[model samples]
Target chain A: MVIINGEEQNAAGLTVAEVLARGDYNAARVAVEKNGLLVPKREFGGAVVSDGDVLEIVAFFGGG
Target chain B: MIPAKEEMLAALKERIGGDLLEKFQSSAAAVCGLGGLGSNIAVSLARAGVGRLFLYDFDDVDVTNLNRQQYKASQIGMSKADALRENLLEIAPYTEIISQKVKITEDNALPLLKDADVICEAFDKAESKAMLCNLVLEKLPEKYLVAASGLSGLGTGNSILTRRVSERFYICGDGESDVDTCGTLFAPRVCLCASHQALAALRILAGLYDV
Candidate 1:
């Protein structure tokens, strides 16, 4: 099980892309971080998730 | 008798306390995007006697920006950076205002933001904000970043707030509100958000980083 956005989930061996898709997050709008290191948007497809890995997804909204 | 410039500065120091005032006078901030949020943040920081400000904007002062942004009708044709510089100088003449008329991107953000103690993210687009925040957090980890993400139409003033994302990142506004849902942009709410950003920056500069 891996932690995504602080929620526990069974995501071992899943790529970042699969994890994002499972969570229904819009790929184009969010910046993802894995264990405090940024996973550049382009490499999401190849970065795999491991047990207990922490992921933080931040979505930006326009205003200021 | 007319007071000397030093006398005036001394008066401010007496009001804010010598140590705090000195911190404000020594700290530098880089404000990206001289729109409503950026311009207002710059204005407040300048008025508070912040020592140096680096202003960036690629757009000219459009007539449409007057509704919320800090610009005058007479200054419509001028570049946003130049017009904002004029505004800041009028408030705090001693402040070092470095205005640049160019777009900031991932490729150039580091060099542009490297010197400032704080980076103010006031871009109007989500993509632009994300790009700057990501690049800054990844590359320039030492600098504190204050970003505003909401404050659309005339919603309740209390809904807008300042939130700390992490040790180095802080965001102002309701975090979830936007122009799409709030309808249109207005001055009061937008300025409120700008104040939050400015206050957060000042706190960071003064070493009040508990938030």
Candidate 2:
């Protein structure tokens, strides 16, 4: 299981993008950090998760 | 007549205590947008007697911005950076305000934000907010960043809060609502988020970094 935003999830084999999509997270509005490293916007598609990896995603919205 | 800068700051020092006042008077913060969030964020930093503030914005103060922004109606045609500086000067004359009339992009983001002790991301658009936050987290990992999101519409004030994403990165907002579907941004809600950013920045300045 991969840890995402402090929750355990069975997403070890999926790409970062795939994992985020499952949670209904808006890709354009969120920044992702993988295993203590930030995954740039372009790399989200290529970056895959591993067992016990941690992902921190913060989504942004409009209006200040 | 208004009190001189020294006397006013002295009273301020007495009120907040000398150590905190000294810390505030020695710290510097940068506000990346000059709208509702940025304007109020800048004002709070000034009122706390932060030594210097860097204000960035490229737009003019339009009538539409008057609802939530700190700009005066008469300053409509003025640049947001200059107009905010004018208001900040009156609020905290001793706080050195640097008004940079430019949009923060990937190219200029690092250089422009390198000097601040803490950087507050208060842009009005999601794209701009993401751009600034991503770049800062990736490139300038050492500097503290306090960003806002999900502060649209008339959601409960209790929903808005400051979340610590990492050791140096913090985000303040509901983490759910979006203006696209939430309708127009209300003044109290925006101000609440702005205040979160302001207070978060102050806490960072004072070595209080939780939440």
Candidate 3:
């Protein structure tokens, strides 16, 4: 199992795109980092999530 | 020797003294984007005697900012941070002002925010504001950040609201207005938003909220 946003998930073999699709959020609005390395938006479909990986995702909205 | 909290509290009581003043005297704040909203917020904080202020702005004062900004026409062409510092000093000569005339980016964000007890995000651009907020939230989750949005025009008074979006994040101003529709801001609305931002900062510094 892997953690997506601190929740334990069974989708360890899923790609970043799959995870975003499951969450119903656009990949462009978020910046994802896997273990401190930024996963570019273009590579979301190709980048795969593995077990014991720490992921941090940030979403942007209207702000000052 | 460091004065007792009670003694400091008493001195502050002569003015804004109380639990809020006590908390404010010990707090350090960083304000980014010294435009209309940011300038007003800095002035309010200085008047309230916030212990230290870290002011950041890369732009020079322009003719358009005079309508709502706390700055004057004479300040045109001067660095916004410098002008704000001068104005704030007139209100609270004892308070410390750390002025930085530079654009905030990932590389310098930590350096500018290292000692800030609270960060006030007052940048105008959506992309820059979002980037800074995301960086601060991701890298410094424990730090409190108050941001503003939707303060673009003169509209219904009820449009303004100060909301706590998360434990460490808060936002103020109307969410419906934008720069496109609002044209330029008037004094009343900008001041209202600035007051809300100041109140939020005061509350956060006094530990009124868990965040």
Candidate 4:
């Protein structure tokens, strides 16, 4: 029941880490935002994804 | 004879039109880092007749930076902020340019960014970029922040993209092209991303992009 990056997923009790793992996203390179707030990297393990929650995960690329 | 202010802006005004040009001339822009992206952002703003520019960089121009950065061989050994200021002046002599030869950290980011209507983040490090983005979103919540990333290697030019991350944060460059993957940055892609940052800043300044 979570919307991740515009796609709906049945993530009722998944932690940020679990959701990321399910999607095969590299946690090290991606920054996560949950409900318009940035989730600190350390909190991904504890941050949970509930029904109707929205998440946007962004990745960093190096350049000038 | 010192021409009137209107006379100085007539040519640019004719091109960009009076209204948008006026907005540009009245806006102030802050560029953090005078490297490849920062230098080009500064110069692009200058040519677009941005009213004032505040630039920060503690590094000196190195010969290696000439590959993708906006600098000349003669500029090597010069401070980046000063060297970039010189280049900006060549394009828009009347544009007010402020150069700071100090590294911008969380402590000084606010004061340096306060006067600017829009902010351009052009640091080379991902950590630095994240720091500035966090600082602006947290402290200067009202300011618009434009940043660049993923512009490395000679990838397909079409791969580079500009994305709006939030209400006031815009990111330019492909989300995937990292230096670790490409191993080197080519000039064309870097400049394309820089140009995107510059255009984003201008759009925010001109009220074309809502902050």
Candidate 5:
């Protein structure tokens, strides 16, 4: 299981894109972190989730 | 010429206590985007007599921004940093206002914010906000970052809140309302988020970080 945003998920070996798709997060508006390291937007598709990994996602929105 | 420096300090000390006021007046805060949120945050910190303000913005005051931003009608074409500096100096002449008309990027983010004790991320775009937040979170680990996200639309004022996302990062906004879907960004709601960012920055500057 992968821990995403502090919640456990059965996402071992799944790509970040798949995880984001499952969570319904707006990909364009978020910054993803894999285990304490920031995952740039370009790497989301190729990066895969592994068991016991922690992920933190922050969403950004328009306006000052 | 409103009052003497000693008189103003005495009044501030009377209101906020001398110790905390000193802390507030000794630290500096960097406002990355001199738009609605940045302008409001700068004003609050200036009134509290934050020793220095690094106001950075590359845009000029547009006619449309007059609705929510702090720019005056006469300063329509003036750069945001310069215009805000002029306005803030009028309010708190002693508070050093350093305005920079330049855009922030990952390469220059660290050096640009090196001297700030607290940084306010008030960009108008999601990409810019994410870039600055990610850069500061990774590169400038010693400084505190007060960022705003999902602060668009006419949402309930109470919904706009300040959340301590990490030891050094604080996010202030509803975390849901985006301008893309909301179709509008009103002054009242924008200012609400700005107030949250301002308070968080001030609290950090005062050595009170528990938000």
Candidate 6:
């Protein structure tokens, strides 16, 4: 079980795009980093999420 | 025996001194929104003895605002700026308040922020937040603006994040979550962000923190 936003997520063999689609988040405004490595938005569909992976997604609002 | 403003000044003589207090009292800050975050920030600055607080919020307090906003149920139909001014005076009667019950647009942004040494951008909507940010950055080149974003949710640990965005600007709060997702905010988080903002204002006023 992987944790998406601290919630236990069932991502046994799912890609990052599938995970985000399941979570109902916009990929455009969010930056996904896995284990401190930046995951490009274009690769989300192909990038596979592994177990015990520490992922941080940062979203930006309209700000200065 | 009684610590009036003068005596309070005398007591803080060694720590802050009369000269600094005088400067603090003469300096002005404009808070652009009187919503949840703005309300808390305004009250905290007023209590901290910031000389003049120019508050702007076009909306009247609705019943929905009682959840996390600083106003009471009795103030539901009142203008947010007026209600905030009244609330702030309860804590420090001598703190001067300038209530502007109007929205911050490009036309009026300069006038409202012209004399402001520090500006607290507390607008909730992203469009308004961006508008104010650009307005202050482009129009008021010298003023220090502390803008808040990403303050949402229930956890205290995730509620406060302060970063200096530019030479004259600082950003505080979670940086991701929003009011729509988190619903109403708790005082703990709001206070944390407000305290951070007030500290930034103080440092700017004291010439300790230059952007």
Each candidate's DockQ: 0.60, 0.83, 0.15, 0.55, 0.66, 0.09
Q: What DockQ does model 1 achieve?
A: 0.60
Write the residue-wise lDDT of candidate 5 on B128-196 in tens digits: 998898778777778898999978887788899888766787899998888877889899999999999
Over 4 Å off, model 4: A12-31, A40-47, B1-5
lDDT leader: 2
> Interface RMSD, all models, one decimal each?
1.7, 1.0, 5.1, 2.1, 1.7, 7.2
The residue pairs found clashing in candidate 1 are none
lDDT of 4 by residue, B7-125 (tens): 77998888999998889988999999888889888889998999999999999999999998889999999999889888877768899999989999989889999999999999887
User: In model 5, what is the error at residue A6, expressed in angstroms?
Assistant: 4.2
**In terms of DockQ, which candidate is strongest?**
2
**Residue lDDT tens for model 6, B1-211:** 3347776555555567777777788889999888877888888777666789999999999987776678999998999989998888777777889998998898878988898899998877766776676567666768988877776566665557776654677777778767676665666766677677777887778776753
What's the C-alpha lDDT at position B131 in model 2? 89
Write down the TM-score of model 5's second chain: 0.97
Give the per-residue lDDT of model 2 (tens digit) for B34-106: 9999999999999988999999998999999998999999999999999999998888877888888998999
What TM-score would you report for chain A in candidate 4? 0.89
Fraction of true contacts kept, per model?
Answer: 0.65, 0.87, 0.14, 0.59, 0.81, 0.14
Model 6, C-alpha of B206: deviation from truth (Å): 1.4
* Interface RMSD in angstroms for candidate 6: 7.2
lDDT of 6 at B19: 72
RMSD of 3: 6.3
Per-model TM values vs. the true structure: 0.89, 0.97, 0.75, 0.89, 0.91, 0.72
lDDT of 3 by residue, A1-64 (tens): 7776667887788999998888886564555667755576668889999989766554433323
> What C-alpha RMSD does candidate 5 show over the true interface residues after superposing them?
1.7
Per-model TM-score of chain A alone? 0.89, 0.92, 0.87, 0.89, 0.91, 0.79
Q: Judged by lDDT against the true structure, how good is candidate 6?
A: 0.75
Cα deviation at B166, candidate 1, in Å, is 2.1
TM-score between model 2 and native: 0.97
Q: Over the stretch B1-211, how does candidate 1's per-residue lDDT look in tens digits?
A: 5456587678778778899889999989999999989999999998787889999999999988999998999999999999999887766777899999999988877888888999999998888888888788778878898988878877799998887666788878876676766668889989999999999999999898866
